[model samples]
Target: MEPVLLALKFLVPLAYLATTAIYGRLFFAPEESRFARKATLGLAISLILHIALLLCLGYSLQRCPLGTIGEGLLFLAWILAVIHLLSEWLADTRRLGLFTLLPTTLCVVVGVFLLRPDFALPPQLQSSFLVFHIVASLASYACFSMASILAGLYLVLHAKLKHKNFDITFRKLPPLDKLDKLSANWSFLGSATMVVASVIGWVWVRKDGLAGMNFKELAIYLVLAVFLGAGISRRLFGWRGRRHAIAILIGFLLMLLTNMIGTHGFQN
Candidate 1:
């Protein structure tokens, strides 16, 4: 098992790289429809290997794999890969693969290389409910990242159109409406997942009779508020077009800030 885990530590990143390359080729050469199937196969294979690697690492450590920043990043990479693959299967569009998988590959490479398994898992963090809460939070973050990426692309394409710059890059991107819809879908998913995470945290707090909130908890709640606002504005006020897209981008930024504060705290 040790040897297998060691091998997987390296194989997972390579698999992500190979999968990303497949997506790149598919995106640049849309004429060759053959690459579509190949891309999907590569993504699926990479995702499977990534999952196996994480599971093995967790088993060996006798703890969740998210004990450190690197491990948390690996988990995010896994979730991003999972979401992108599901999007491809459900939407039947490979247009977003290159954009999505490039960051995923980078995350895997950084995470795999930066892994610090020697770090001890805190005893207080071993509760199953806490693990679920953290998992849910990470899942929400991954979805928010996806939503932001989509929104950024939409903005870029929108700018190109406004400037009358119709290049191959513009043509390669999904249509504005498609990008808008995809971004909205991912944002909604992120919001819903964040709600779940918040609920889990609340339940854990009540179950343990915790008295006070930590900085990380405050940040999470603030991030949740941002997403909830975005959802409400879109639903009730009929906010659409660039306004909604920009709102999503802003929410993503807030999420990132929350992560940073959670990681570093405000002791200074």
Candidate 2:
């Protein structure tokens, strides 16, 4: 059942990528403006399909789709897609979607392909808190990744502007200040989520099965601390621009590493 679900997950992402790629090209094309509208419709269709597939998986498994590396990452990708779409509407930017959503879909597909299908849930993961923790952490990671991209864009823009040359791509971006504010806000929100999740996780660990200091526990703490500390600095000293972007990238990388090490090594 797990393997079949794992295989089925691939279809949704493939559908997603196909649609988004079409959107990206259509959005950039000069010949026709209809492409953007068409592409957006495609994205909408793909999203609905993805959500339905996930619901089916959850219903069949009678679990919160957190059972394995593949399921978790794919769901994370779904979340990122949702967030990306919402942010696009809120921020009023179509160009950014091409960068953030496409890679996420690809990565989710790859994660689903590589991860084990029958990965059993441990005794400790039986609680609702575990779901909260996992969901919060992944959502935060997605935002931070977005922030990092914003930062990278800032770098490229700043460089071109510094050289006294106008780059078309840079001009399309929201004002420098707007992008900076968005990145900071994303990280700040992500950090808050992580902190809340971590606190709940502590309670879950205390009550369920985890009492000793496990490597995974330590990793979670380290990630929580990194984001919290960064958030504090941003709030106090007005952290923004390149420095903020670098910090977001660094923090997300730590979170990813901890996830990889814990899920793979500990499972054996």
Candidate 3:
């Protein structure tokens, strides 16, 4: 098991790195989409290896692999990878791979460096409820991260069109409307997932007789508030395009800050 885990730790990141390279090639020279199928296969295999690695790590620790900040990074990479693959298939767009997979690959590589497979969970955090909360929270974070990437692309493409600079990159990008729609869809999903995760966390706290949330936990609520506010502005004020995209970007930053704080607390 140790040998398998060690091999997987190295292989998982390498697979993601290789797949990201393939996607980078496809992004620049989309005419070479003959390689897209092969890239997708590689990404699928990477995702499988990622899951297996998580399982092995969890089994080795005798707890959920989600007990530390580094483990959260691993989980987030897997969630984002899954989201990217599904979005590509559903939206039928392959050009966004470079933007998405670069960060996903980074997460896996950084996670490998930081992962402590021997870390033990405190008895207080050993509940089934905590597992669900962590899963949903990570899912929400991934969705927000994806939405931010799409929003950034939308702004870039919008600028290129405004300046009348229709380069090969512009031609390769998904249409403005598609980017807008995908960003909105991901933001909505992130908001919904955050709501569910928050409710579960609240219930768990109450069940455990905790009086209130800590500063790190409140940071999560800040994230939820940002997304909720963005959603409300969109529905009520008909916000879209640059305005909504900017809002999503802000939420993404907040999510990152929140994760860092949480991770710091865990390490302490």
What is the C-alpha lDDT profile of model 3 across 113-155, one tens digit per residue? 9998667777668789878999998999899999999999999
Cα lDDT listed for each candidate:
0.83, 0.70, 0.87
Give per-residue CA lDDT, model 1, range 145-181, as digits (tens): 9988889899999999999998876888878888888
Per-candidate clashes, comma-separated: 0, 0, 0
| Candidate with maximal TM-score | 3
TM-score of each: 0.91, 0.85, 0.95
- Candidate 3: global Cα-lDDT? 0.87
TM-score of 3: 0.95
| Worst 10 contiguous positions by lDDT, candidate 1 | 259-268
lDDT value for model 2: 0.70
Best by lDDT: 3
Ten contiguous residues minimizing lDDT sum, candidate 3: 259-268
State the displacement of the C-alpha of residue 118, model 2, in Å, after optimal TM-score superposition.
4.0
Instruction: Report the Cα lDDT for residue 220, model 1.
Output: 73
